[model samples]
Target: MSFYTSLNGLKNAQTDLGVISNNIANAETNGFKKSTVAFSDIIAGSAFTNPKLMLGIGATVEAINQNFAQGPVEQTGAALDLVVNGDGFFTTRSAISGDTLYTRNGAFEVDDNGYILRGGNRLQAFPTDAAGVVSGNTLQSVQVPPTNASGAQFAGVAVGKNGVITASYADGTNVAVGKIALATFLSPGGLRQEGSANWSATGLSGTATYGEPDSGFYGGILSGALERSNVDLSEEMVGLITAQRNFQANAKAIDTATQISQTIINLRT
Candidate 1:
């Protein structure tokens, strides 16, 4: 029982170490957020031989949560490179499939198809009219049409802090295309975790509320910049060492318990 308890501790420590390693590895990944492992104590049995609790079971992983804290903003000199000055995510549609996913990383490129995509996902820009007016006022969903190469330089491309997009001609002519929209949830932490540093809305998160960046409740947009990863290398290293020590200590305990069991068995032999 003692050996099993120690084994549980080792498992939990290993899991925590894995999470720390991932944070360190993604330290350079743009818009990456570090995750922390939470542990819960497990009880083996009630205290019978003594007044104090025996406390046999060690620990188990409770959850790994995303830290939504903002990262550093860096300029890349690319017009399409975008950084949120406050809070919000960039929505993108999958190239292969039309599924949408949201992210804070704004490192984007104009693909051969003329659709803006970040990290291989085609960015969804809301459609505007000839006058370049945003179709929906934060109440509308954005759709990206197939690129027309002969199309006159994205006539309606306006980007607002609170989800406002203003499109114009390449020759410095301004037009009111559409307003960019932001989504806020009742409980952001309640959102479901999808790998690749993405999140999916859940019941706990409630429905997303749309707004324009920096206009109302949404954050403003900063062109030619990107949000850096929030992972702190020094902090992650410290966590790694602590988890290692815990793992070693638990392993030693298991070894000691094994020796004790062996001695007891030898008495009969």
Candidate 2:
């Protein structure tokens, strides 16, 4: 029984170490959020046993929760590099899966077809009228339309703080292409991580609530900037040290228990 309890402690310590190591590894990953391990004790007792005499068998992992605290924002001087100044995630559609994903990583680039992309995923936004007003709740892929026969060349693209995307032409004509859509959740920690700093809404997170940036509680977009990873190296290092000590202590306890068992066997012999 002692050995099993010690073994459980060892396993839990290893799990903590792995989580801390992952956080340290992704410290430089943009838009990365760190995770913390939670443990719950396993109480062993029969219904007839005295409540005060219940034995704690061991601990089990209860959860691994993500920390969604805001990370630092850095200026990248790239027009497509964006950061949410408050709260919200940029919505995107995966080309391969066709599943809607959300992310804080605003690093984006335009393809030859004039579609704004993050990897194979296309950025999603609300369609806008000629006056730049949001038209409806439906989301469309953000893109720069091809130059027309009128000879107006594609000049530049701009993303406003309010999440509006505008395309400029050499002919000095500007068009409101779309309003970038932001999604907020009732429980952000319940979101499922899809890697590449992307996340998908889960039943636990509830359905996404779409809104324009800089309006209401939605965060404003910061163009030419990006959000850094939220991992703190110093904090992770301390946690690593603590987990290592716990592992060592549990291992020693197991060794001591084995020695006691061997001595008892010798006495019986």
Candidate 3:
């Protein structure tokens, strides 16, 4: 029974190590959130010898929660690169499917369709007039391969502080298209993790409120910039060492218990 408990401890420790390693590996991933493994004490059966004291089975990994602290803001020379300074995400729409999604990573680029997409996903923006202003809380549908302009070229489209999108024409004329929308969740931690650094809203996440970046408490949009991952190397290293030591101690306990059991077997022989 003691050996089984020790084995559980070893398994839990290894799981923790894996989490830390993943965090370190993604230290350079933009908008990556670090995760911490939490453990809970596993209690076995109560001991008849003492009613007040119950035997502990061991500890097991309980949950792996993301640390959503803000990462360092980086400046990229691309006009599409944006970093959210506070709590919000850039709303995007699927190109082929037309489904809506949101992301914190502002690293954006114009695709073949002349629409903004990040990480191979089309970014949906409300269609704007030549002036780049949005009309109301509702978003207007904007299709890529923008045909409203004279030359059908993606030129001089800029996102402003009020979520306004202004595009310049080939003749050096400016037009207002539409604004980029930002979404904020009631509980960000409750969001479900989707691969490719995207998150889907869940029941626990609550409904997401959409607005423009740099509007109504939302942080201003920073063009030509990306946000770095927030994983702290020093802190992770410390946690790594602690987990290692704990594993070693658990191994020692198992070995000691084995030796005692061996001694009894030898005496009987």
Clashes of each: 27, 0, 12
C-alpha lDDT (0 to 100) for residue 32 of candidate 2: 91
User: lDDT at 196 for candidate 1?
Assistant: 62
For each of the candidates, the C-alpha root-mean-square deviation to the true structure, in angstroms, is 3.7, 1.2, 2.6
* Most accurate candidate by TM-score: 2
Worst 10 residues of 1 by lDDT: 140-149
Q: Top lDDT: which candidate number?
A: 2
Tens-digit lDDT string for candidate 3 (82-198): 787787877766666766667778887776666667866766556665555555666644334454447655455666666565666566666766677778888888878775667
**Candidate 2 clash pair list:** none
Give Cα distance to truth, residue 252, candidate 2, Å: 1.0
lDDT of 1 by residue, 86-200 (tens): 7676666676776666677887665655456676776554456645455654333343333233454554343454444454555555554345555567777776755565566
Candidate 2 residue lDDT tens string, 1-269 = 99999999999999999999999999989989999999999998889999988889989999999999889998999889989888999999987889999999999988998999897899999999866998998999998887733679888888999999888888888888899999999999999998999999999999999999999999999999999999999999999999999999999999999999999999999
Off by over 4 Å in 1: 44-56, 125-134, 137-163, 192-196
Candidate 2: lDDT of 231?
95
Q: If the candidates were sorted by their lDDT against the true structure, best first, what order would they fall in?
A: 2, 3, 1
Please provide TM-scores, in order, for all candidate models, with all chains considered together: 0.83, 0.97, 0.88
Which portions of model 2 show Cα errors greater than 4 Å?
A: 148-150
